[model samples]
Target: MSGFLEIRRGRAPLIVAFPHTGTDMPADVEMRFVSGWLARKDADWWIDDLYRFARELDATCIRTRISRSVIDVNRDPWGRSLYPGQATTELCPTTTFDGEPLYTGDGPDNAEIDRRRATYFDPYHAAIGAELGRLRAVHHRVVLYDAHSIRSRIPRLFDGELPQFSVGTNDRAACSGALADRIGELCGRSGHSHVVDGRFRGGWTTRHYGRPDDGIHAVQMELAQRGYMDEPADPSPDNWPTPIHAAPAIAPVLSDILSTCIAFAKGKE
Candidate 1:
């Protein structure tokens, strides 16, 4: 409940974070953008809604209503690339995932980028840390599940269609090997395409707070938008952001995934 950042506390030893589902754009910030539509195009559209079942598991949920177009909370504030040589956006991105310019004029300068990081990015992570501390005090182990979604095809970012389930543990540096293996086993039986440590291997949040030795097991689940919603091939303002209609089969799978996360945190193994 800190400005645009929202945190719902739960007794369960699990936390779900939505870093990119936000669409709120401040007037001053929007004025500098090429178009609001384009700025929001790459958002993890309706992702928070897709994972509504998290609440039923009594899992804490943390989210930011401030759009990623404003400042990607999941990215490293120090400006280091999470993927190093891969195609990705910055902490304060100047363009969309498709390499399209996002601002009418030159994007935010270094000073402005730093300001955004302080005003928006810092608080988001702070909230996450606070929740983790609270949950960890009660349980020996806690799970931080970073939820994200992207278009099935973004040629600029990856080759061919992205897998439906893109689980990332920073090559298993973020979470315990047992946790990673459990998630991998679930995805393998999901009847959907999946890859581990592929094009995406978790972002800064996953890499930073994930300390298995300290009992914080973090994992990032990046879903292909096509799995839960209609993703038009050529997305325009008119045909973009197809409504979220979780496929009948996909709904149960998502439930099971979160449930498994809860079980894992409870040491159910």
Candidate 2:
């Protein structure tokens, strides 16, 4: 088992990835942070629990245990902005989403960034690529569902409260048109606010590995944190990550989404 990542193997033609759910901050890295709370504030909180049901579909799951504060596994290793011209975090962010500084000093320099990338970034993608290869070997098609979540309101990054479900296919270039449409339809019927190919149209993982022609269909599901948990207008260390509802409001819709993903990979949708 790689200490950096956790991988659960399955035979199904589906892979569920949780890139921002990690909160592990190595001692050396933690020392540079302004505070542990700010360092972990932007993490996709409780995402591991939110999507735990993916295990039931026998979907291969890959999750990084290293906090995004150390290195964002879903980001481009070369430091290219996923959402160009928009305010977003970096491969190794030095600030919180609210634009608060996270580092005591000048944060990670180029040398430190490179070191973190080699230590954390590479292995995460290797695991993902390895899983994709394994699944593709057994099945003609495989679906990589990159799961994530964020607070509903972050004006610095977005204009208004984000939709309950932000489904992204990198402008439909990552996955099949039919698959995108299916997810849109389900979200539309779920009675929750949702948008497709909006502000967030997937990330480096989706765009890099999503080769439909190669039998790999990738999609990113960015759920607004409000849908499943209470999102304070102004979050603090204590009240930020409210417990995920015993029964989240978006549970059934999420189930349908994953089920459809499996069906699409199996050519049943």
Candidate 3:
């Protein structure tokens, strides 16, 4: 696709969005990284593969092939800190989840951050915003699921390990009570451990666009990489890799969660 972002159409009221699954960067930008490859580690590798069966559910799937490290699409474009006091990645991060320096002497300055945001972030969100507007116009209500994943444990960011599913509705502010309840219930039935509005209370995209009062609902699912990938405690050049075969162990449950959300959106419509 010529556009940095890719949007696929489905008549369903649900949009399965992958906001952190890219690994591509412009050549000039790639050279800025400490070692090019480290920059790609933050991507939600192979997320589309997890939703390989999304089309079967008639979902409107939207994805990006650019790595989040290049420019986090989930973050606030204004550059305001999402967690305030707590540690979190920046609009242009200087380190990985483990706090490993991604750039050498200096990272992207304010100007570079703005440049990347203009080149990729804004365009990506524009597509997301347009698609959500389209979906809601058609259904009168639309559900946006911001999909993401991270290694199970990252001491620099959080203590211990992350749960398999960390569902965030911005403390229930970004979506309807009905939407959250239905998705949470489905997660329980699917037998996968989950926490609602816990460590991750949603990101900028979820909080900014999920205007249920205006008939738009948004949710974010932060999956522990262990759930679907061969994650490592400390990543290296080769030892750890992603794209683990999707097994029935977690597949049916994920489908149930997504299916329930889809049905919930249609119900609202």
The TM-score obtained by model 3 is 0.95
Please estimate how well model 3 matches the true structure, expressed as its whole-model Cα lDDT. 0.82
Candidate 2's C-alpha runs over 4 A off are none
List candidate 1 segments past 4 Å from native.
246-248
lDDT of 3 by residue, 16-111 (tens): 889888888887777778876788877787667887777898888888787777788888898898898888998888888778888767888889
Off by over 4 Å in 3: 246-248
What lDDT does each candidate get?
0.90, 0.91, 0.82
TM-score of each: 0.97, 0.98, 0.95
Q: lDDT tens digits, residues 1-269, model 2?
A: 14878899988899999999988888988988998888888889888888888899898999998889898888899999988889998899988888999889888889989999998899889989999999898898999999999999899999988999999899989999999999999999999999999989999999999999999999999999988888887899778778888889898899899999999989899
Put down candidate 1 lDDT per residue, 1-269, tens digits, no spaces.
13798888899999999999999988999999999999999999988898888998899999999889999999989899888788999999899999999999999999989989988998899989999999999999999999999999999999999989999999999999988888888888988888888888999989999999999999999999988888888999999988888454566777888888888888898
Ten contiguous residues with the weakest lDDT in model 2: 1-10
Candidate 1 global lDDT:
0.90
